[model samples]
Target: MRISRLYTLLLPAIVACGGEGDSTSTTTSDQTLDVDSIAAAVADQNLPSDSLNEYLRENPFDVDALIERADRFIRSKNIPYAEADVKAALELDSLNPRVLLYWGDVNFYKNQTRQSRDAWMKCIEVDPNNVDCRLKLAELYSIVQNYRESLRLVNKVLEIDPSEPVAYFIKGNNIRDLKGDTAQAVRYVQQAIELDPEYWAALDYAAVMLANMHDPTAEVYYKRMLEIDPNHQPTYYKMGMFYLDQEMWNESIAAFTKATQLRPSDAESFYNLGYINLELGVNDVAIDYFNKSIQARQVNHRAYYGRGFVYERMGDLIRARSDYQQALAYNPQHEPSRIALQRLAEKMAQ
Candidate 1:
């Protein structure tokens, strides 16, 4: 149950476009773009979020172009733009399945759960065999903890197309969430990989699940995932976490280093590096990492707490107390930092 809950937190139940305040760093280590990739993206008009003004200007009522632009906006996490495009598309053709699909997506990101569900339902009503919307509805049900309905939808998708990999993936995820039966849960995801060898989502779920179980076989899946999408932050972060848990110090550092290189503002990865070094009794390195974590994101209460722990260990009660107070300032509900401050106060009294 403990392992199950950990991975549940790790893997979000709802896979949707990022809302406001969600991480959407599209730059390199120092928050700069790769000039080559930027040039390539500019040249490649096929890129989802590439400027669509010319195309839309030529064919004002082209539902396909509107839907395409809406999808691109969604991908870019521009919910307002996406919603505008979705509205235009619906005005042009209210019954377009793709338009409905992205309408659901836009509403989902906006936290309008009922509207999102209704959009998807309307999509399925228009085209009963829309596997994408079906799978999406399944994910939605799972999000709302309606596991039985989620499974029913998954089973329906399987019946529609036995080879649908996402159906199997959803089944696996729902099983893990609903029942916490890891062994049973993973078999379905493995089946998903067997059906679609390059299914990145399934590979991630399977790899992370195995990692939680401390299974060395998780490395194989992680490697394949990196091969498929090397710069994916979650992959590197999760792999780093797995290595940290296994006490594979060098491996964890390398993975997290890559993550930080790709996303220098990733304070959590920095904090993990600090935690790992602290566990190894490398106080200097640990303090350096904790400092880096705090520098990367000043509101990172955990980083402050971690640095405080290192300070306390090094007999710097004043500094430790200051850090703890800073952590609490950022997040008053941070229990560990609160306890640390209390401990420091007691020590100072003595």
Candidate 2:
């Protein structure tokens, strides 16, 4: 029962092309060109596309070259070109595990989850020990809330490699969401961090689990994460909620302020800041933050309710009533806004 509206970040499953022991290693070009750098250069039109075009023209049937270019297209989020390249590669070698893996990646990015799942399943069928394909399927299952299937797949990966940190992290998330076993979840994620202390995803989840348990030592984990990756804005947001849970208003405010500064467009951070200001009896400041939250995301009913609260506190009943109405308009089922409106109506009748 995490009280924070902030979403947890789940690391993406390792696609086979980028996974350990990827078969694509055999398809490398002698040029030793970095795909990302080449893609950036192409985007800037500084690199002539004719080089790749000429290569493909000369080797029209080169499955390896097609797959290699497809990998670059996938990285650059050019899914259409990725799909075309992978489809061509599959035409030349339909049973190629590496080509199937790229096809899966392409379809996954295209939001064709079923097609992506089937492609990965085919990859597993072709190579029974394809841990990357298994992990991708597990991620899809998790996304659809099929935690049982996800856990089973991850367990199979652990059987193959017990020291897999990402497997432990995935297992921890499945257990926490499916079974509500925070303590057990913490142990699993902690094991991941113990295996690879620099694993940021594991550290993030460890901090979250510790925070849920109200363990003050969660701050230590958060500080360690910041030391590792200072640009991680979600850590600051989570820390603010952690402080808010303990009623540490100033600390919460500072943490939330930092998060807002890092990600100015984050409506949740703005809303949380407003809520904290209201708790601290700073009506005007709370109102301003709530307004900013609404501006960031107009559908944020929580912001509207928070603004209403501040207006009510300041004896501005008219604006408070209007804000309550606006809140209900955004979320018809928001009981707080409904109750507030009801109370306001009664007060007017009196």
Candidate 3:
């Protein structure tokens, strides 16, 4: 019995309903039992280079003491202090690139998108060669779904420095969003990998593109990613999907089960497992898994549809109608649910 998991596409436009996708209906039960608080605790100290600390350490006499102060504030998530420090630095040196960059970052964290853009633009104006500023601005644009501008900015960075692996990674993402051209996206990511063999993000993106396309290179890249980072949850989940796609049911189940355990809060994993059960004719078990999937992800239309099908099989028309309607509520374009509802209606009329 080869259980096939759906080829789920990542939709950047869709904001997932936030919560742990657990099998319980209650809020507390829906939360993951395993809380890896250590990760959150060390998140602030993830990398000193990620702070302006390393940059400041190298360029000690870089005009603005306020920039370092702002970095400290930003790293601490002290928005007011960070903003005040940047403003004070700007007062002293209005055109300082470091100050502008920090200010832009603070603005971004604060969700002041327009202000962030303005600050980054100011930084670029002061230091046209500042790759960080350009890259950040490009990323900000991409976040706002302006892929064209993001691509242009990254292309500009590549024009200046052809060996910029980070730029290549961002360019690849933008290419995917704008054109859905997997080949071009893979090429850009491959360029990034060629520039920096240890580029894990590029490898992940490449793996995702290849896997979705059912390319033979997918397994190779996925194995390479695992070699670089064995415990990366996304890679594990993706590997599970790849196995499911390959009709390796036992392998898919193992991978998906591991993925769900690894990322307990991931709704998609539970949903995928449930989908596999549906294909495998484990109706009762499938129903249980689907219930968990819905509990984990309130807006998961697939779970609703699958549950509806199971309810139909059980000769429970009322539950079937409820699940079908719920599915339709989540996704009006869900054709399967619509057809199922129509059939149920016809059955009732008879």
Model 2 stretches astray by more than 4 angstroms:
1-62, 145-148, 197-201, 294-301, 311-350
Global lDDT of model 1: 0.79
Q: What does candidate 1's lDDT look like per residue over 1-350, in tens digits?
A: 01000012223545432223232332122433232443344345455444555666666688887777656655555556557767878988999888888877776666655776888889999999887778777888877788888899889889898998878988998898899999789999999999988887789889989998999989999999989987898889999999998999999999998999999998999999999899889999999999999889888899888889999999999999999999999999999998898898899999
**Which candidate model has the greater lDDT, 1 or 3?**
1
Q: Each candidate: what lDDT?
A: 0.79, 0.78, 0.72
Q: Give the per-residue lDDT of model 2 (tens digit) for 1-350.
A: 11111011353443432223232322222334334444454556443464675577678689988787777666555555567678778989998878887877776665556666788899989998777777777777776778999899999989998987777888998998899998998889999888888888789879987998999978888998999988789999999999999899889988889998999998998999899889889888999999999999999889999999889888889999999999999999999999999999988889
Candidate 3, residues 234-306, lDDT tens digits: the string is 8888988988888777878887787778777777878778788888888888898788787777898998988
- Positional deviation of 324 in candidate 2, in angstroms? 4.6
How far off is residue 60 in model 2, in Å? 4.4
- Whole-model lDDT, model 3: 0.72
